[model samples]
Target: MGSEAKGLALSAVDPRAAAAGLTPGLPLAEARGQVPGLVSLQADPAGDRAALTRLASWCGRYSPWTAPDGEHDQEGAAGAMIDASGCAHLFGGEAAMLADLVARLERLGFTARAAMAETPGAAWAVARFATTAATPWRIVPPGALRRALAPLPPAALRIGAAEAETLHRLGLRSIGELETIPTAALAARLGRGVARRLDQALGRLEDPIDPLRHRTPLEVRRGFGEPIGRREDLAAAIESLAAALCRRLEESGEGARRLMLVLHRVDGTLQEVTLGTSRATRDPAHLKRLFAERLDGLDPGFGVEIMTLAARAAESLTARQTGFMRERDRTVDLSGLPELVDRLESRLGAGMVTRPRACESYLPERAVAAAPPFVTAYPAAFAKGPPRPLRLLDRPQPIEATALLPDYPPVQYRWRRLLHRVSKADGPERIAPEWWREIAAGATARDYFRIESEEGRRSWLFRAQGRWYLHGAFA
Candidate 1:
């Protein structure tokens, strides 16, 4: 939402693009080089998926069948597929609900393409792959698959890369060609992927896209003193709330994957914060630390009256076993999260603790987000990824300088009216967004290096366009 875009892919919209000349899979560099003035950003899959999940949850406000689509398979951000059939009248009609959803997303800066159909697979294909000028999103009558997908690309078939490639090599680029090929020969050569894709496209195969909901038990609360304006006051309120909340979770025989704190302000506005743990825990102290790091947003101008805390997305609770020969730890039963959340809210604010969520997008910055206190835990582990700063600049700031090599640290650098000399340095971890990411081609590559100043202080460093900028701090 800043210099870098927020949701959707940067590749989705490039400012330099003329008449939207951009094509899928085109190198971001070449695309940007074509449009020198393109402004772009990295998308956040985490935020996107979280928003989608919330939408699915909010769908209950409309119809129980509403579900989100396209999210991280892990961490409960897996988006969903919904069935909005004869239930259209539930919201006055399908068109009205669709309009309402679009309006809701638009208010949140989301542009969506929605379609309704008899089958989940067909609906999904139409929602994303359908061209506006061709078959718009709608419920086609029975026996309409041939008319719906005959002209579309192979992707609408939901086939894998290898089969799609084979079809492309044979000049069978559209679904129509594959349809014309004998099913027997196609199955003989390309095997099940091609056959299954064809079957899915034609609605002969049943395809199910499940809505992601954490199986964990949950508890929620709506507080009367919503904002709790002062930081300390908010923290105090949170403790008792957390304890009460934990007691609810304990009764269910499951541990929460996340915890959400919703502050329905006196003004009817909603502010949320979330927290997560490395392990399933109701440890109050640990939650306080996590929340303390992020509680600056709760201004508590008037006062918060309604606070709702819900914990969903769960797993069966298990006591931790200590040494190989030892039994489970006895103290593991302590659900300290309430006490910790209490201290943190009082110290930080009413709505401060949060946990990171995984989003399903190819964009870098859009891959993770601080979920509201609802999601109770973080990824057990992340794959090898770009080096992240212990402290990251709220936004990337351009620097003034030249670089023979984006390494060896600059001899001198200036920031916020201070100048410093470099003394030591470590590597250049190159991070690049996907080709289809909606980011500027010129800024696609970031070389993050660890640098030490003459004062013997280590800092996170990065160079863009041969200019050096200090990005973060390191202990």
Candidate 2:
């Protein structure tokens, strides 16, 4: 029950209360008159939000991307949104997934109505408004979002109660009728929200789901009956911890990317060992092997009483189907690369291994960047552009050059107090500074040229503000 301007009102009602013609926002006195023995409790909005958040977190079993539905209606009913893309196949199919989800929720004493569609908005509409007693779950097939959402009322679009009332007064009761009217006309009559919501429901506009943040890291701990100080015992403990953690990760459809092993020593001190993988993985044996390398120099320090292995960072990693025959397998298994990188990092140090990653930038220096080994970089996009030098200088060196006209390739340039005459030169390739970046006071466009010295050493030279600089050398 909630307080209203007049008196106490029903904030929400159970199925029995709803069936007895009692609705939310109805006066408690009138609701009691309609249904004599009405049981009503004071509403707790904060608690409801917290409960919904917990429910959303629990939904991580279905999909890693899950969030409590931010939109609420007059009835004060709460819901959760799950982005089950690429996850449905795990539970058989979309229909099976929905059935499983609803069945699990029902087992937990929740009356859930689930619907799947091309978009979250459509799913929300269909799940709340279109679902029936016969079918508590519905799946709007791909490319049928418009038809599925057409029959829903304007209120189903998640518009404000007043806005929905206005749409109803204007004889636009259904979403189909609202869609028939021009967006601009509807916006003029109602507001831009109606059009925007309509577009989102129909998949015309993208509606992104903001997943709930995990407050605590997924971890498993073990308390030894006797404090273990020996290296072999510690290794065995880690192996067990890794297996248990991997089991939890598999159950949640997640893989650990970074892990932290916390050791509570008997001397009231703590020892920590952190391990990071190049990619997400849940293989217990691989985790044990990786941890083995880091365990060499670990000091048990008077014996460890408790050991906790926590997955500091994790990501969704679905099950993969392996081919029966290696010869017939068309896909390459590059899983060994991450294992190698993890091994190297364990021996050397974190960030010791790196790979060149192509970046979206026009500046030669910013075009390529050092990234983690597993980060995939696409260099094919740069293939269409002029070839970049194999070796680029850390910083462009200032040089003296003699050229003709306002924009021309240098005829000769002096670098490091040595003069080199240009034998053959390519025309200047003009490159403008990125406008989106902060421009310095004297920053100007660069005109680059591929020039070869008479002695046969080719260098990349660029002229900015009529000053020449050697940027890179070509092999």
Error of 2 at 441 (Å): 46
RMSD in Å for all candidates: 19.1, 15.8
Question: In candidate 1, which residue ranges exceed 4 Å CA deviation?
Answer: 1-20, 43-48, 55-60, 65-67, 71-80, 131-136, 214-475
What TM-score quantifies how close candidate 1 is to the native fold?
Answer: 0.41
lDDT of each residue in 96-215, candidate 1, tens digit only = 666665565555555445666667666666666673524334554567867877777776665665676788898987887778888899989888777876786577888665644432
Error of 2 at 46 (Å): 1.5
Local lDDT at 86 for model 2: 79
lDDT, candidate 2, 1-475, per-residue tens: 9999999999898888888988888999999898887888999888988888877866655565689985556676678999888778866899998997788677767888999999999999999999986899999999988888888898999889889889989998799898899988988988799899999998899888887744334777776868999999999999999999999999988999999887867654567788998778999999999999988778899888678788889999743332222766767765576778888988898999886667877888888787666533333335358867888998999999999776878889998989999998896888788867737654678999999999999999999988899999998
CA lDDT, every prediction?
A: 0.59, 0.83
Candidate 2 ranges beyond 4 A from true positions: 214-475
Pairs that collide in candidate 2 are none
Predicted candidate 1, C-alpha RMSD: 19.1
lDDT value, residue 141 of candidate 2: 95
